[model samples]
Target chain A: MSERAKTPLIELHGLTKTYGAGDAAFQALKGIDLTIQQGEFVAIMGPSGSGKSTLMNVLGCLDAPTTGSYRYQGIAVGSLDTDQRSLLRRYALGFVFQGFNLLARTSSLENVELPLLYRGDSRKERHRKAVAALTSVGLATKLDSRPSELSGGQQQRVAIARAIVTEPGTLFADEPTGNLDSVTTRDIMELLTRLNQDRGITVLMVTHDDHVAATARRTVLIKDGLIESDLVRT
Target chain B: MIWNAFSIALREIGRNLTRAFLTVLGIFIGVAAIITMVTLGQGATLAVKAQISNLGNNLLTLRPGTGFGSRAASAGVPSFTQKDAETIGEQISGIAAVAPVRTASQSTIYLDNARACAVTGTTPVYFGINKWRLAEGRFFNDADLRSGAAVCVIGDTVRKELFGGEDPVGARIRIGRASCEVIGLLAAKGQAGMGDQDDTIIMPLSTLRRRLIGKTSSHDINQISISAQDGMDSNALINDITSLMRQRRGLGDNQDDNFNIFDTRQIAETLGATTQLMTMLLAAVAAVSLLVGGIGIMNIMLVSVTERTREIGIRLAIGATAREVLLQFLVEAVTLSGVGGILGIVLAFGLCAGLAHLIQVPFNFNLRINLIAFHFAAAVGVVFGYTPARRAARLDPIDALRHE
Candidate 1:
């Protein structure tokens, strides 16, 4: 417990998010408290309408909580403007989605180099780093392939390569393998487990599938926008 | 961030090549039209002005009576006879020379080869007044006019037309029912508004008077060409001529002068003003095309933003500021317009050359106009490209990522 006080990478307290205004207002998040420490692989699981997606948005820094505060690296992230939030997302969080979100009309190398591009890397440097990132995701031969040219599983791999290319502080993946076949899903889960154990990269994934959630070292269950149970899998 | 956005823009445009080209076409036509119209219009004006100035600074042309447009065929106004020419020569101060002219049209032949040609009857001074230089042989002298000799001087065009490349000097050519000898050949002066100077056959004034018209009149002198001495006041010279004409015509103190005296400078200014107005009108019409081009850019940009929503969301998630996103698409738009503007300049020159040939005006492809229009189109692209780029930049990543 004394070690838990050393400073978690992400700490949120009584966070609440609402949409619209007046009588049409709908609360998407309600009184949520969560902490994610460095080098911790955690999975969030919940049924539909449980506010798991909304919580993921706040956790990923893609949106701001209408109530309470979020501290990133001990700095209050809620105080930052849109630009800094974007910078935090780029430098601190690597995101992988079920849809992959790969840019069309672009190659795998360019996709992986995107985050580094915001870091002011030269074209030559961007190319070298993007190549290295693709290799890490077992896409060494598919650097020039556009998203449409690759299979679904391969495209998802390229997307994962893009997410982890920047070596971000935390990786936030929401249903990263939901769109993959059973074989591809197993391969992706193996990749995530290896990244967590070998690379020691912290991961926060949201998934409803028990098999997918079982790959993470810890799992947190949310019900009605509240954490109903937390468990560690050995 | 800027570079990231730029690549996104470049790739998007590359993906939609057809849309990109269509967007810049508007600017292309606008710029090209502007350049072509202005160049040809200004070139023609310059050519005319240069030719007129080449006629010399000391020259003046006088036409008889109040009628300005009609003069050559029949003297509708009172004729300035030998007596009036002598009087103006003697009384007008700072005057150089006075020559009375009569011109009639006839298609006569020497060797059965007949072509319609102008027969000009004037004194030997007509050669000097009109700055006609002799290419071969001598022009008519006082002896030719005094003797009413049937001798003539042929312009270069008529020399080529009737004489076919032959030296027509010393050759006999029929003029107005009387065969005359071609004593001299005038130098080639190309085409002018009055007609081809080289095509006219100039003869002794006495011969044209007796042979062509065969009638005498005191009220039918077509024109008077005057010249003031160098370093002399043209205004004072005009006043002297005006007063002399008034005295001779027997006008009262309150009566308006029957004849008109015009300044070449005034004609030049009026001509320039008309040309300038034409240039402005043409340029304004062409500018409308440029606006249409900007709309094209806006249209393509809107499509691009819609198509690349996911890309924009990804960039935003990866630390791209709105400014980066904006600049990326904006630069793409500018590049399209800039390339189109360059191509437009080349096309403008081509159109100018073609039109100049059609209208017989000197073609001048000016670089200054091209550069200005190039920059103008580029600016249009940037300004028009901003709204769509800004909108794309400000889109919510959460929403965009979720979009199908």
Candidate 2:
């Protein structure tokens, strides 16, 4: 386990992202070099226009870097084609958005089972895993409730269940608690910390609030497309 | 994977039932209209064939002049004689029977009733040629023709009008100035293309010319009906008859024959072709509606893709491939139109049956056309659904997620 922890799960070197072309171009990430180990809970923090979301997008394999290289478990992500990247994300990565992003008019159970559905799991297997995931998030009783019927915090919990339903190695949360009240944010933070410690699932989150950032074991602060400081609590 | 996509599509459609229903309404109307038109067209064609075949099997009527009308019956044209009919009967190889006909509308009085009826002068062979059956009593015998006896066979309508439910057989009725005894009651032949066949009286040609008309010198006849032997081609017989009449009439080369020969089979075929053309035309119009329905589907699918952008983004983020997303939307469109197609088929059946009964045509349920219509509707779904689905699939997850 110590030897496995020594090998980094994600490694980024001189990564940069630019939007648009020619004179219309605006660089979102000037350069980003970061390494994260397995089973770590890290928070990425930045003010508006600091490119933290861009970094999270690149880390989540949703966007490609314009320059430099990113390696997930020593596999060069820049060399992967769109479909290959999709496959990598399908098997190794999961996501939770600030908006919850659960399909509208769908029940909580079906929303939670969506990732497993994409994984091509059988109906019975999807139901079993989704129920287990929802139960872990304290939403077992709200299985048939739609997002409209659920509170914002409950919807976020459903989103979290969906992310972990496929048992992916890493979870990327972009402002997961941004839409929740402070009390519900604490409850969600507790759930994330428990999942990180108990299941050993690596959780990387982006937040502007220092209070939300305090829940993570490590914090990386970005300003003007560059990491200003990365601090470890322990 | 396909099943999963289909279920997802069905669920999405089920979420907004009214919108989905409105979207597919065009498809429903188009399919139903096409099917009803085709079915009715087939029934009309069948009715035409049945009506024409009622005239007689392999029957050909040779009438005076080029065609039927005032111009054809002008004074310059000469009518056929009984000798012409005899010569054709002897000369034509495939001829089964021939009957010379002379018709005149005359007022006949029986008891206290008087009715204007068609007085037909023909022979015993006319009964066989026209497939006429006797409801009661016997037709004129050879002796009756030889003696020029005033005995007639009354059609069903004539019997009912002149006799009023009383059997007219063996009853004497005065036609023109001569009294004739009704020998046979002809069975009802109903309506044919020309008109009602059951409103005439038939007698021997010799009896009508000698006794009723009071003319023994002129042997002019209005028409000659010829029946070909079974399995004989009417076209060949018509060609032969045309040549014979031309030669007998002594027309010079390059002179068009003044007489017209009407073949019942040819009439049936021409009428059938005309009805089929009409069917095709109506079906083509209905097909345009189907095309419009496809366009409607495309329009709605585009809107649906736009409305569900964030949903697509969520699926993409959760590890759905582009192809999977495309399949989901494609299946939704197909399901929408397919359901519409099924509903259209059901509506078409009801409409076809109801209209057929109302219009007095047969209700023809065509399985092949129904199948083709359904497949075409589904195909329309695929064709129209492709663009919107591709648009959904190609969307950038970040941009789509950001969309409100």
Candidate 3:
């Protein structure tokens, strides 16, 4: 088969991230090579300390890889300076944490406005976009309810609104339902699936749950520091 | 961006209101203590200067033998007489007037009203030599001085203390076994080291010598005061008095003069230097409290960073520049300090007012210094609030996201 002519969204070659140094140095990621195509929703699965989270960080540009080349849309992301990397993070990446890290004492609408604020959006645009985002996450009715006032499921919905408000190129979710109950987890998964299927949003989510992995069209499993398998099952 | 950071800071402060309040309390107390203590020190310096300047500037006091602290308490000294004062005034070139003083203290009882007070004995020129004003009747004249008249001038304080403000002028007041008519009221002069100059009765030296008490020796004048003319050189006047006194005392060229001439202007430098040193010391002491306040700010910032770890992770993951994170936390710190500083200034002024009334220190209510202190407090907040904010901003998001 001809090599895919379409430019990859993320390309990581010989990627490694180490912690500490000398005899105490522990390698979290060891020579990981991965490619993600445009608009492909993927899932990463691994046991604890398998370096899946490390892989996600490199993918999200939250950190630099220890010794590797990371190309995002043909620009060497791994080589970008702090400000350039910040610029990349500003316009290209969205993040959802497992614990539903919604800012306390803030409205759902304002939570969605955070990423837009980072982009220096005008106030009117910020408000309109935030409202639109809350509508997308089915949080239009809970605009003013604080994080403490919302249930785990509703809080997760608010967090999802926050993530996509910027309309970034990629959405990275790190076990987005780890702290939620099973029913709430299912609801959040369905929401993620809708974003991937209907809106053409590229999503990479990390989860140990097989059910969570099943929602994605492709799943990659890592054991130790290297990827053991990549399965495509639509 | 600064406003946004400030809002976040305000919100964070509100999140844990108790912690914020306690943190600000440290800065507030430090600033307040500094402001109040410095104000007191400034007020004391001003009061002392005013009192000394009001005593007289052109006048010099010559005490017999070596005198250090007070006018009357120099020991082992051969006393000088009023005749010495007369000689100095007549013989010296630049001097305009001379007066010698004698003092006594006793219990005065007049018709069932009794109070203890001091009495001063001086010449008719005593009123002119020092700036003593007559509030009621006339002061002693040349005719009275030459006749050794039994007329006296009593101060407002003496009138209030002894006669209950019943117009002691022209009243006959008894001093020991002698009776003297109060010729004039000396008016209010506030306090002096002469032990409340306003609380004394003034009488002629001749009357005090003849009627109040017999002379124990040929020398009874406790202090001899010389006032230089308005257009005359005070140093030259002093030299003339020194030479004249040396010749009158029969001291040879090698012998050091036993008398000491003190100028009120000389005390200004010594007192001014002392006051400045004391003010700096007070300010330094206050600065220690500011250090404790800074520690308080650091402690609270550390706690805030710890509590907001997950939030920081979310911010970083969502494209916040590290500088932004740093700025937001820095704003929180600065906000605490700024508000604390403002409140501290208010508290300081309040403390000054209360102390001015209670402890009775001089308070001019200096507006410029007050403003400077407020701004300084804000600056302290900035200086002390920077590092912890930077530390919080620099936290790694990947690790922070996993932080419990």
Q: Which model scores highest in TM-score?
A: 2
Instruction: Considering chain A alone, report the TM-score of candidate 3 relative to the true chain A.
Output: 0.95
TM-score ranking of the models: 2, 1, 3
Model 2 TM-score, 2 decimals: 0.93
Q: What are the candidates' individual DockQ scores?
A: 0.68, 0.69, 0.56
lDDT of 2 by residue, A1-234 (tens): 566666699999999999999999999999899999999999999999999999999999999999988999888998887777788888999899999999888999999888887788898999999999999999989999999999999999999999998888999999999999999999999999999999999999999999999999999999999999999998
lDDT (Cα, tens digit) per residue for candidate 2, span B197-231: 99999999889888877554444788999999999
Displacement of residue A86 (Cα, Å) in model 2 is 2.0
Deviation (Å) of B71 in candidate 3: 12
Best model number under lDDT: 2
How many Å off is the CA of A63 in candidate 1? 0.6
Which pairs of residues collide in model 2? none
Model no. 1, DockQ = 0.68
Native contacts kept, each candidate = 0.77, 0.67, 0.65
Candidate 3 C-alpha lDDT tens digits along B235-330: 777788888888877789997777888887567546756886798799888878877897889887887788888888778878888888888887
TM-score of each: 0.91, 0.93, 0.88
